[model samples]
Target chain A: MNKIILLNNRPTGKPQASDFKFTDENKPEIAKGEILLKTKFVSVDPYLRGRMSNAESYVEPFKLNKPISSGCIAEVVESKNESFKKGDFVSGSLDWKEYQVSNGKGLLTIDASIAPLSTYLGILGMTGLTAYLGLTEIGVPKKGETIVVSGAAGAVGSVVGQIGKILGCHVVGIAGTDEKVAMLKSKFGFDDAINYNTTKDIKKAIATACPNGIDVYFDNVGGDISDNVHANINRFGRIIVCGAISAYNETSVPTGPRVEHFLIRKSVLMQGFIIGNYVEKFPEGIKQLSKWLQEGKLTYTETIVEGFDTIPQAFMDLFEGKNTGKMIVKI
Target chain B: MNKIILLNNRPTGKPQASDFKFTDENKPEIAKGEILLKTKFVSVDPYLRGRMSNAESYVEPFKLNKPISSGCIAEVVESKNESFKKGDFVSGSLDWKEYQVSNGKGLLTIDASIAPLSTYLGILGMTGLTAYLGLTEIGVPKKGETIVVSGAAGAVGSVVGQIGKILGCHVVGIAGTDEKVAMLKSKFGFDDAINYNTTKDIKKAIATACPNGIDVYFDNVGGDISDNVHANINRFGRIIVCGAISAYNETSVPTGPRVEHFLIRKSVLMQGFIIGNYVEKFPEGIKQLSKWLQEGKLTYTETIVEGFDTIPQAFMDLFEGKNTGKMIVKI
Candidate 1:
């Protein structure tokens, strides 16, 4: 028997566990040129929350009563494909189930000796590529310039701040908790970190952190936090709009301060892009990220929730900012 | 004797005639390597409003009780420099006075036979350079793309729309009056024109006009009109923030719909710039503009207010959308 989870309901605000349903189904059969994979780990990212709603987005919305899916690390138990073989570890988009059938089309074989299998879904995977591409391509941080990152404790933002430091920039991060702030400074080497949740005036806090003003802004949390950051941006600044996790779960369209005057006055540039836009440069990005990791210039952390039943809870935790880094469900 | 206009008081909202005071002063004398210039035509632009305030901006604010200065076309009455001779027509920044003393360093001799002297204050000058640089650099319009321009009847916006047409793009113009809208379509060769003043729903109007969606936006009006234009932008849209005439007179900071999520979802790029930033590329811009003028591909209009006393009134008319194109004060 194969157990899978389906999206049962659309969430209005914060998602509830009841929005997902767990059920059992017959194991899928792998035909010729196909591989049968046993699930090892499932990635629960903030972007998944956007798929839960029936709204037009970069990706299609998740259909009701359909198996919810995301990035997953799996082991091939059986393979009819010459590209993959039994006992080989692979990574691909897969449903939240114990077993799945794949044609090995989008699946990539993973080398366990490079790093842990779960990290392939995180630091060495889409998360790392997102941070590297968005920061370098859009933000374009220069040496001695101040780089500010919002949602600093999250998977992508943590890497962005670390890369900013590596490029000889003064990095400042805004996270939700004091613990996350401490992690950003102590572990990630962020020059300064502010706990946005406890700060009375975010604008003042940002001003204090960035004495010379923000030259590059890697925005993961949009809303008031972004407004504050925009207010403190330097002349010829760059703002890379990565994600707006703060407004993702809102029932209505979110609104905040307009930035036209700010941008015009400062001669700033604000660009919004997804990692997929840089697909042609992924090999370059992965090569650099891997090199940095090997040289011990980069580090990452993960919050692993064991058991297939914890997938929904782990995903919902993203909206609550409960995970310090990449959130994963280990089966 | 030299008659000049000085700033009587800083304006809180919309400026008034009383904000300027006319005074008489002794004629300035030209020293060695300098020229004594008799003012001919003064350029009254919307950007001047930003300099009237005590706020920090790209250019320093005008000092209290000092003569207001702007781009002016003048005749060299006496020359002490080898580069300039008496009776030569030149353009440069000059105080709002009948006569000015210049070091001939920043002055550029203009050939009146090439274009009208007043046009040197408009089409062949800063206004034309603004349109060329902002459109080509930031807007980056492609052939077959749809370009929407706000304040389309104004100096910079008019040129931007015409350039879009020359680039084989579908051009749409948004103006404040029906007459201006008609001029944009009939005279300026814009493919479509909308009267934003009479439109009930700007968003729906933009959607109707730009059926294919806006690929590039040359924004001069930055309030609800811009918010509507931003909503109708296509994927990978580009917004060139040139000016914010709509908010220039607002007593408090203006607020409108936020665009971070919109930019993120569509992978849009928004950039703000002043023409001065492209000083190094002026020769390139002027060559293109001069070629278009000579080829009869570009035409410009100006509303000339005779007499030096009318300078303040002409400037105030910009905020009211009373000028069709460049507003000039002939002194």
Candidate 2:
């Protein structure tokens, strides 16, 4: 029996598992010029929580009573379209279901031999593309400049810090715990790492670490962390705000240090970016990421859960800062 | 006897007349390569507030017990240097005193034939350069883009709004009073105007006036007005924070909405700029501004106060939102 998880109601805070229900459902039929895909892996991301809420956002909010969907790796079980044949592995955007029918608009064939099929859903997927686009286009790191990244142990932040180091910048990362901070230095080649939980004075700590002051701040955790980062930026500094995970689960508008004045003080440039807007650059970014992976210049690690039923638990772990790198649910 | 106001004390808040005291002192002999300058017109700007504070800034803070000084148009009464002679009009950074000696390094001979010598302090000086550089370099306005300027009646803001209109942007300005707003629309050619004081909801007011959403927000007042302007910005919006007069006097760090997250949502770019950084482009900017003035394509206005003792009062009046356009003290 095929089953799907429906978003029965909108979440107010950290979404409870009860908000989703998995039930038996009919397999979708493939129309002409469409292919039938059996789900192999469905990627769950923190950004999906944003889609659940009804707010002004870059993408449309998810509909109530509809199955949550994202970039899913699937197997083409049957095909009505000449482009896709049976037993081909493909990746595309679709509902959280056991099976799906695709018109091939967003679908792309994947070579499983390159790595694992799941790698496409993480490093070479939307997550990696986001890190690439945000850092390259917005951060614009220069050699010898200091680059600070928040949420440094997470998927995007880890990559951003690593890229900063690769570009010959003095990379400093701020994480929630000692373990994550260690991972930033050991795994990502970050020059300096700050565990915000243990730090006595964030600004002083950053100033001590980066005596020259920060040039680019890749902000993932927006709140007080962003404010402290803003205070340390040098003249003509750039801030690429990718996510505000600290504010995502908030019950109210999160208040921190007012940083509007910092813009004028440092002549700092702060910008936000979404990956969807840079679709044309994705292939080039993926190609570079793939080369780095093959050459051992870039490394990625994921904390995977065995069963699809653990999706909600894995997602909840993300908010609690349990995952070190990309958190993926493997079937 | 020539007397000048000496910088007596660093001001904690709004500087008082007591912070400065007129003292009779010896007219120091002009050394080799130095010239004696009699102040013709002295500039009192909002940025001087920063110089009074001990806070680390782009320029050195003004030292107590010394004559406070800045960019002023002066007449070379006597010259010990070959570069400049007596009776030559020049512009340079010098003491606030009636007569002083300056080395030739920072001095430039002013041409009085083209425009008024005081115009060098407004439309042809640092104020004009600020408006030109901030709009052209950072604001990067495209033709027909809606340019929103805060503190529209001030020295820099007025020039920015007029330049925006010249650059083909639909200019909208925010001012403290209806009169200033009226001036923005009638005198400066702003497409629309918003009196922030009278408006119940700044966001709604900006939204109603700019239906397409603000493409570029040249922020002069960085408080709630900036927050409202930032919230109403469109995708890929650019915000050039030129000054934040509203927050300069605040005793504590002002509390408001977190704007770093908006960078992610709108792909907004917020940058701060000082006009001094673009000195290389100054002559070109002046040439264009002069052409605009000569052709009657642009209109310039100034609120001139006679005498030098009113400098403190002029600086204080800026905080109270008194002056309509470039506030200048004629010596």
Task: Output the number of the lDDT-best candidate.
Answer: 1
Candidate 1 per-residue lDDT, tens place, A1-331, comes to 8999999998889899999999999998989999999999999988888888987777789999999999999999999999999999998888888999998888889999999998898889999999999999998888999999999999999999999999999999999899999999999999999998899999999999999999999999899899999989999999999999988888876777668888888999999979878889988998899999999999999999999989999999888788988999999
Tens-digit lDDT track of model 2 for B19-131: 78778778778888888889988888888888887777778888887778877899999999999989999887778888888887778787899888988888888888889
lDDT of every predicted structure (CA atoms): 0.91, 0.84
Candidate 2 residue A274 Cα shift, in angstroms, is 1.6
TM-score of chain A of each: 0.98, 0.96
Cα TM-score per model: 0.98, 0.97
lDDT tens digits by residue: candidate 2, A1-331: 6777788778888988877877777777878999988888767777788888887788888888888887788999999999899999998887877887888787989999887888788788887888878888887888999999999888888888877777789999999999888888888899999999999899999999999999988888889887788888998898888889988877667766666667777777777778888999989999988887788777777887767677767777788888878887766
lDDT of 2 at B238: 90
By TM-score, the best candidate is 1
Worst 10 residues of 1 chain A by lDDT: A251-260
Docking class of 2: medium
Per-prediction DockQ comes to 0.78, 0.72
Taking the tens digit of each residue's C-alpha lDDT, what string does model 1 give over B100-143? 88888788999999989998888889999999899999988899
